[model samples]
Target: MPRNSKRSTSIRFRIARSTVNYFRLIYQTFNLDIFELNPTASYPEFEKGLLATLKPYRRPHAFLPRTLGFAAAIARSAKSVFENARPIPFNANQPLFVASTTNQKLAIRPIFDEMTTDSFWFDEQCKECVSTHANRLRIPFIPLVMLKALLSKGYRRKSFRHSVATYCEIHGTYLAFRLAFASSRPSCIVISNDHSAFFRTLEQAARHSNIPTIYVQHACVAEHFPPLNFDYALLDGQDAAEKYANKASRSKVFLVGISKYSKSENESRWTGSPKRIGLCCNALDQTASTIEIITTIQKSLPDFEIHLRLHPSTPASEVDKLIRKCPAGSVVRNDAKTVNSFAFCKSVDVIICGPSSMMLEAAMAETPVITVETDSNTDVYGFQKHGLCQTATSAHDLSNLIADIETRDRGAFRKAISYFCEGFNSPSRPQASSLAATLIENISNRQQIPTNWKQSKKHGWWRYSSNEPELEAETTA
Candidate 1:
């Protein structure tokens, strides 16, 4: 053959190899592995262990298949279990989705078969198996309520077991709900007030259903996670919104106001003293370091009465212990009066917290605030720089900060708060709730795909401006 022919054949071979490699990469990127199972697969072993461990509590009828393939099929079948699981669209006359953990019975009723026995071993083993496999499996097996019920079966001595059981119950309920609603809902939006379990469920549901989901950042927005393919995100401040926007390139991100204390009912009750100081308390044992910082601040400001509100999740006994540790008349036990955090924020003059959403709520209320970071690993400079709150790193710093706050120019602090909140104090201004509602409506409206969209060869969701010139020229002349 001639030299030109030989060169052409060589080039063709190289091109063929490159094409094969490119196709292989694409296949690996999008491949679904639900049907694949190996001999060493942990999911099967976990299922066997879980079934064996939970045998005493679980009904005989609950045992169906022990293999991975069968479990995948059951998970797939569960997708069609509910056809009307989506939330009703919000209308001017209709009420929005209300948060309810109220009839816990409704969520726990499905696990009655697993609540019969008082075997502590069965409960402990079941919880261990569930926690070990929860993050690894696509479908979460143990519901959170079932774990809670098992805990109530009298194994209080095992704290880790009890905690894992509580988590599993919540996780299991979320998983069951996700599988049930997968086929019914076109999309879902999760509104959570800083609960990791709720957020995990939202992510799992979105991934399983291949549906668009949005997360409204309900607290400090600095916490980072690997960006899921969320359709949109709403943040508490512009700085946070911009950070996520740059990081999550595919998602539509917006800087909306915080959502707490937005209701007219709560706003009407904002009658707390102008200079009152509020200290939001967490669990004494879990946040012992935080409580120590609070003690230091109390000693520095003996004249300033600090109103400490216990977290709703903290037990009554824990609150009592915390009160005893603090000076008399320094701790305020208002946990019973308010059902939600926003309601509690209404009566606070100045809020102090440790990476809590209460700090953001205080900012939304246009109140001066301080955020303490006891952990050296956590950075809170963004919160301080944004004028949302003053960041204190130690007990000594907090004590000095409290003293400084008393002498600081009140007018300057008010102006800083106003700038941070973007005029939230104005009587005519709409609250964060209204802003959230409006943004949701707008996004939902734009989410509709065109009827002939399938016929078009275009790849993206948006129209290209470059195509505009061609259409304009064709129509004009």
Candidate 2:
């Protein structure tokens, strides 16, 4: 097999094994085999049947309001339905990208300002703020059709919770995308992350509508998720490009540098005291382990202060519970809004984390990192592999790492971080926002081309190689 194929095969094996294990757990707990799908059924056939059965419930939605504005929007969209109107030409006249979040908006602020473009977000809370700044569209309700589909699909919930979630997402997002683009279609859709099924559906919908989608890397793409054939993917550095070059078309992959949100000072010597260590928290899964490690570190290095910086996505309640368990004045949680992650790096001498993109951010800010390896650290470009940071498999090992931290070679550490994370290698490296904007404009100005994954062989279910034997990997979301 080709190198890419081998890697993908390895990932497939892992996923299949995980699925089997999940079913085994279900069997052991409830003595049920509900995870089984029709072995010989074609995917299209199954989907067609499901959609047809649920189509009836879509009609007779009398509860939905028929306001004049809604009717007017539909009337306006009638032209697009019949004639298939083309997107507005890409130019400096206005923004052609639809940012899904406020952070994404700020990431490309340079492009948005320089091009005299418009931007919008799908968040309700950001509606007022975004409208005052740029443009904000109200999110549409999940159509009755999608709700009915989910209700019918709930019968398969006995199989796994993911089954229901996937069924709802694939349909709900499709409907939302259709409505969002019906009235005002942009030249392209720009999104930050590919982790969500909603983003996958949005990409599919955009392709169907003859619009291109661009994915700006928001984090490390290390997990075995479904293939997303975006028209363009802006990456952080040469390493990032190499990591995803096979996943996307080589032509679609562009090394546009690191995240624009990061403010890494060039040639900043980390002469700060090594006593202050920052612990970066990722998903809720790592909460317990991280707290345990923190406790161990506090006890080992009594004079050192350990600060916890929770991921923006992590629930505040999880942090509160974890903090209550820690010794008073032992671990302090950093407020995200008040303290920027890079700023936190500036304050701390070294940072420790699970598998999070913040490691790259911290590294960019010239903060040495020590990654704690656990069952959930699935990042392909893990810290230890790239020589960017130290790794410890257990709390005991981590305690030793902290004790011997002063012996690390700072000169070599800075070099490794710059080599792995683009833009930080030198002050002359290309900036992310400008590079991304140029690629976006270039793609939009030309004819829209289908992505490579659209033409390649796709696997069934979560979409892996169908012929490959099962192996061990993380379960699909």
Question: Could you estimate the TM-score for every candidate?
Answer: 0.51, 0.61
Residue ranges of candidate 2 with Cα displaced over 4 Å? 1-94, 101-183, 248-251, 261-269, 282-292, 313-315, 374-380, 393-396, 403-406, 447-477
How far in Å is the alpha carbon of 369 misplaced in model 1? Answer: 2.2
Give the per-residue lDDT digits (tens) of candidate 1, residues 36-108: 1111121233223322332322322222322333344345435534323333222221111212242222111
lDDT of 2 by residue, 1-477 (tens): 799999999999999997986565333323211122111111332333333322321222232332332343334334334443333233332225545554555555545544423444334442322222111111222233234334544334221222332332343345445444545676777767554544555666676667778877765554233245677777665565554544544236555566554444544535544788898875534556876887888788888888888777767887788788777888877977567676788778788886566787777777778887765564445466767788898988988887776677766676666545554534443455655665566565664432311222231101112233322222212
Residues forming the 10-long window of minimal summed lDDT in candidate 1: 468-477
Candidate 2 backbone collisions, by pair: 13-471, 14-472, 14-473, 94-117, 95-117, 95-118
Q: Which has the greatest TM-score?
A: 2
Off by over 4 Å in 1: 1-211, 263-276, 284-301, 328-330, 336-339, 371-377, 391-429, 445-477
